[model samples]
Target: MSEKSVSTVVIDAPLAEVQAALFEIGSYPEWLSSIKKADVIERDGENRVLKAKLAIDAGMMKDRVTLDYDWSAAPAALSFTMDEADLLTQMDGTYLLKAIDADTTQVTYELTVAVSLPVPSMMITKAQKQTIDAALKELAERVA
Candidate 1:
């Protein structure tokens, strides 16, 4: 329920390519630095990841979180909510993609996080922005 931190980046890739990269959740640790490991817990009928367990270690923030993904919006958007975590009380995120051109896509990432430990609001917000920026950059690199 906390305010979400949002960031948008334009990637030099087609919408389908970007969506493909995003959908391969298990491969995230290979590109996303903060994510040390990603294990798919469940998959939908289409083989899309419906639940995943992720091990994250981003400097001051480190936790193993299990998340439930909502893929009803597919190709255009993907959203996830944390089902369980050691340190994180609430972790919810969404990725919105828009085709800018035949070879370009605009990606917007929105995240809201609340920790069990006491942390300043400003620090948490800053960390969230940094995480989003890094994720976007890595995603772009992976797709390109």
Candidate 2:
């Protein structure tokens, strides 16, 4: 495990709406600035993504990554772990949603990732914050 970056944001949408947007894995590139492409490799019986390949360009770091995804219906959460990647040694993250009102939801994102290159912890944390902040803002806009 590497040092983790955790952050939260409030989305101007209901919990269900926010979760729906998050589950639309194939549309990630449209809203997530870092994601260049997202392709589903496999799906479960419920047609939910089981595996996906993503190409990401995050300024200082870039990689084509494959990840295994798990969705927890009870908690309205989505989590993923890296199955393989060109530059990333480990990638694990989760998105947890909590409703603040009928039309507002709080989203918490936590990520821990390690790249193959030697980079300082401060740099990694800085990148993580930028990624998280951009992702949450886009997510909010997508569901708005």
Candidate 3:
């Protein structure tokens, strides 16, 4: 599988705050454009199960998929793996928050999303990058 990746925006909030804000996936539609609905399905230990539906490309494409998440609070890392994703053969994303200074942080978002959907548009990477960008922006705005 080929690797796809992106880096997130650095939020002004502390790592714990940022992590906590991200856990509120249900509020994504308040700030995120592509997210239509995000519902937490279950929680097991430090992992979470989610069912997410996203609208993409002006409602031309939509996907509802299950995801499993693993959070490492000590290192401030949130990792997601696809359970069954449409328009994706395999998908994985991670958010890494590292303390840069007292009131600043370094946030990195990375994803590897594979598309076997009909025609493999050369723009898949661009689209995924835009998604991550919007996510980072929302995170910054919410947690900042």
Candidate 4:
């Protein structure tokens, strides 16, 4: 696994609204350009996504991946781990949300990804940062 990359952004939305946006995994493709498709495979009792399958196409990386979500820390944090993928060996990520004010929220994204092929550590780190930053930017736009 590569070192985790973290990025933060402030969104012009309430905490609940930001949380709702992140919880709606099926809508990811609409806002996340790298995510070509997102399908919820399973949902918990609370109607939160427990598992999902996502088709991603991000330049050099393209793969269909299934991920298992951990919503135990929800309302503030959402985390996921890769379950199956063609190219990814490990994909663990978390989104942490904090209410900065009634109409503003701070979001922090942390990601660690590893591919099946041999890649340089520096390249992996760079890719991770790029992915995290892009995701955060997209999320902010999505909730705006």
Candidate 5:
């Protein structure tokens, strides 16, 4: 079965700054522990990554995943879907950013992933939370 998780964090940075850091895929390994490597396969005219390959190691699971990213301009949300992966059958996620004030922003991360191996539901949930928390914590440091 597939599992989904949603978590939010408030970063002490402007929305634009936070968005910039998030979109800097090349620098992901520096901030995101799970991402071992990231390569941009395709980009829009605006130079944003439309397709990319990611190598990740998430403790209990590891996979080389390719994803297609979509961005919304009005509300400033970036969503992605898994295009291919050896271990992952399906995966999708979104980063929704809202400006709390001039210097604070709230980031809501929603993720769903299905792995090839059968893992306990409780373990999956715990892993998801750890992944989200670590990402947000490192991101906050990067932009701060």
Candidate 6:
């Protein structure tokens, strides 16, 4: 485990719209550059398990993660905790949504990614944070 990175952005869209865009796993690649493919292996209400293969400029990395997503609950927060990965270990993340106004929403993304690659730990953490920030921005634009 290493230092966790958190990135937050405010989107000028309703929570429903934002949630809808986020839940559409198949459209991830359209917004997130790193996500080469995302497959929803299982789903039950607010819980989902997905297998993701991400490709950066260097190469491809794969991970299977289980996420507990809920919008029906108060405060409107979505969170996830991943199982151990073959390449990466102890990867955990959370995304929170809060109503800033009637038409604006606050989005926060938090992740703790343990990199076991040949690269430096700082490099991995920086890349992960950049990816998360970019993804959230793209999602916000879509909802807007």
Ranking by lDDT: 1, 4, 2, 5, 3, 6
Q: Give the per-residue lDDT digits (tens) of candidate 5, residues 79-124.
A: 8999999998777888889999999999888887778888877777
Per-residue lDDT of 48 in model 2: 89
| Tens digits of per-residue lDDT for model 1, 1-144 | 357999999999999999999989999998999999999999988999999999998776799999999998877899999999999999999999999999999999999988999898788888889899999999999999
User: Best TM-score goes to which candidate?
Assistant: 1
Better of 4 and 6 by TM-score: 4
The lDDT, on a scale of 0 to 1, for candidate 3 is 0.68
Once fitted onto the true fold, the runs of candidate 5 whose alpha carbons sit more than 4 angstroms away are 73-75
lDDT of each: 0.94, 0.88, 0.68, 0.91, 0.85, 0.66
State every prediction's TM-score relative to the real structure: 0.97, 0.95, 0.79, 0.96, 0.94, 0.77
Q: Candidate 5 — worst ten consecutive residues by lDDT sum?
A: 69-78
Deviation (Å) of 108 in candidate 4: 0.5
Question: Per-residue alpha-carbon lDDT of model 6 for 1-144, expressed as tens digits?
Answer: 568889999999988788777766667777766666556655655454343333323133355443444434434665555544456665666778887888998888887776566767787678678767877888887887
The C-alpha stretches of model 1 lying farther than 4 A from their native spots are none
TM-score of 2: 0.95
Residue by residue across 1-144, what tens digits does model 3's lDDT show?
Answer: 535758657778777777667766666677677777677777656455344434333132356656777654535777878887666676688888887777777788887776666634446666677777877887888776
Comparing 3 with 4 on TM-score, the higher-scoring candidate is 4
Best candidate (score: lDDT):
1
Which ranges of candidate 6 are over 4 A from the true structure?
Answer: 45-75
